[model samples]
Target: MATVGAGRDAGQNLCGCCDDVVGGLPTGSDLDLLREGLYGCFGGAFARELVVLSPGSIVLAGNHTDHQGGHAVACAVGSYARGIFRANGEGRIRVGGRGLPAIQLDSADLDARDGGLDDLSAMVRGMVALFLQRGLAPGDALGFDAYLALDEPVGSGLLGESALELAFAQGLNNLWAGGTLSGEELALAALRVARERLGGSSAPMWQLPVALGGIQHLSFADSGGAVAERIDFDFAQEGYNVCLVEVGDGRVTEPASCSSILQEMQAVAGALGAERLGDVREVDFMMDLPVIRDQFGDRAALRAIHFWREDRMVEHRVRALKAKDMHAFLELTRASGASTAMYLQGTPRVARSQAIMLGLAVADENLRHEGAACIHGGSPERAILAFVPDSVYELFSQGMNAIYGEGACRAYEVVDEGASAWWL
Candidate 1:
């Protein structure tokens, strides 16, 4: 709703951290200094305009928030942060963010780049610095304003915040300076900026799903980062039902503390030279169960082992679904819920909510009994996925509304479109 234009009359001060020149344009003398310093470093005179979208909620399969690492899924929402630019002929960079703050960067010292200004505004500047360091044309001085908007509902468990920021950065690169930057290149650069510049690593996983979508099974290899592969399945014709239940009053939180659990998992991984937990197979889990229990105390160890096994079961079920083995998929879904209840020690509220939903779906006379349901792990809130007959879509909707109260959950038709870019 708010609009800011780039000009001295706008009456905004440059961010001190970035050493941006604010208020009034420089005369011929100032332009001379700028030209002398920036000409060689920036290469040529160019300008660009760009827009970026935010990322949605992050779903973790295993506990651990602090780089201990776990599997997660995220999507890019419709909202965005945008940047518009115009070359000033002089070496001056002006940036404005709607309803936030404005920043100006003066490239007066090409040989001496300040590294102390670390903040959100500095992120864009840092990206420019990085580009220059790589011997790429850093573009010319320009006047620009950045705008940000988010479309997803607040607190939806989607990583909208991180996604939007990264999208904006990528959009800038693609729009302003035309070049071929692979998805992996953009992802890695965005990840470093989010971590080093933004003080967080949570943005990486979230950005991946937005950049690449569809039903993907993701795994991160230590030396190689994340590896994503699409799972091929025709849900529409296969007659499989998938429902996402919103449980726990929608107050989602990160997974439980995982310091000790990660240490134990690491030990197991070390023995097998497996870089990731997913690489540890069923036999590895059984063998390391006792060691994990000893390290994490009995209860935590038991829950961790249970989740590991159940997660593997889910992965296998995904494979079964791909193979169109409906019976095996249903059985595994039921097993997954049971394991969460007995071994993972999921909250009573979550376990009961999922159980009741699945039970009702199975008992319904009109609804097919060949469906499957299980709790969606990672979110603090209780949520479930039900695989049901497509013919009963309306019936299932009505039944869920009747039981859980109206608007308790949202329903979306199953989609298979992989991630793609769109105008905001």
Candidate 2:
């Protein structure tokens, strides 16, 4: 296995360096595919290819609180999306990846987003919009040609869109802006891109880990500001491992079940005179619980309660991790999952995804006290995060994989160093 990065400033050819920097990647990351895919349109690799890498993130704790301007703890995982960029001097930005057809558009014309934030084309447009807003895009932009690749495991449910955008923007920053922006600054630009696309209301906290790859305890303020503190601790030293469990696929996003939870949470927030639960004091919310329930019904009140508690739990979870208090951290994550499921899970979007409940059940029943599990996020999450003692990792991963699907259970570490975390 090798690191298949696009050649940098040394006039590295995309096809020439395949054997050296491409094989170590995961699915959709084969450098040959990138070479063939690019060669199909262009003749060869451009001189001085600039390679960029960005990691996909997971919500380590604190679910459903981002939109409320609450706290969250996230980690950038080993899964990654990569970009090989070169200045084409063609006044056009062309972006394509393996299995993603090449789409060409004028760089100057990237003034509007063409699709959703998750859409590749639209994400590129969003990135450009942020770049332009920051006066980062050059006046006489030569544009760029980028061939992107990804290393995330299939069925892991990671959207590499943000990574691709970060890689694109980071490459442009280096080529045009003299690489002046810090990793966190680049991440903030990416977050702005997503917020612009999704609007200012939705929670996009996962952006922190993806753009600034590492373990971060993030506190987002009501004014739309953020504070990211690096949680420097080693799980390996504690003899534990964290894995993302993919329950099922094709689970539609924003199903009624998921929307209902948000709607209910918002309804309660409105009743309390705050736009988000995080803005309201916990004691104030608790005192008004009876009234909130009478107005929005019991479920709405329950959801609001979960929100305030989970928001506080997020901070505690970060403390537990920093202090190496695994047992405390493990329990908090589990309780958050329980609260999310009981008060906010709403219902399953599809018949198959009902397996979500079953998956949690299975984990709880089999893993016992030594391990802990939690649903990853709302929108009727199809994945769960499990922390298990490393001594039993082999049996645990194998057993879980047999129940879900082979390779559906992969272990990951807190990737703080090397190219995997280079985005930040």
Highest lDDT against the true fold, candidate: 2
- Which stretches of candidate 1 lie above 4 Å from their native place? 1-143, 159-162, 197-205, 237-242, 250-291, 346-370, 399-406, 413-424
Report RMSD (Å) for each prediction in the order shown. 12.3, 4.7
Candidate 1, residues 316-412, lDDT tens digits: the string is 7657756888788678767866775566554444543444345334434335565655555433244555566777766765676666667544443
Residue 246 of model 2: what lDDT? 74
* Residue lDDT tens for model 2, 193-284: 76676443455466666656568787877446577778877777888887877775555554445567778887888888987887888788
The lDDT for every candidate, in the order shown, is 0.46, 0.68
After TM-score superposition, the amount by which residue 17's alpha carbon in candidate 2 deviates from its true location, in angstroms, is 8.3
How does candidate 2 fare on TM-score?
Answer: 0.86
What is the TM-score (0 to 1) of candidate 1? 0.60
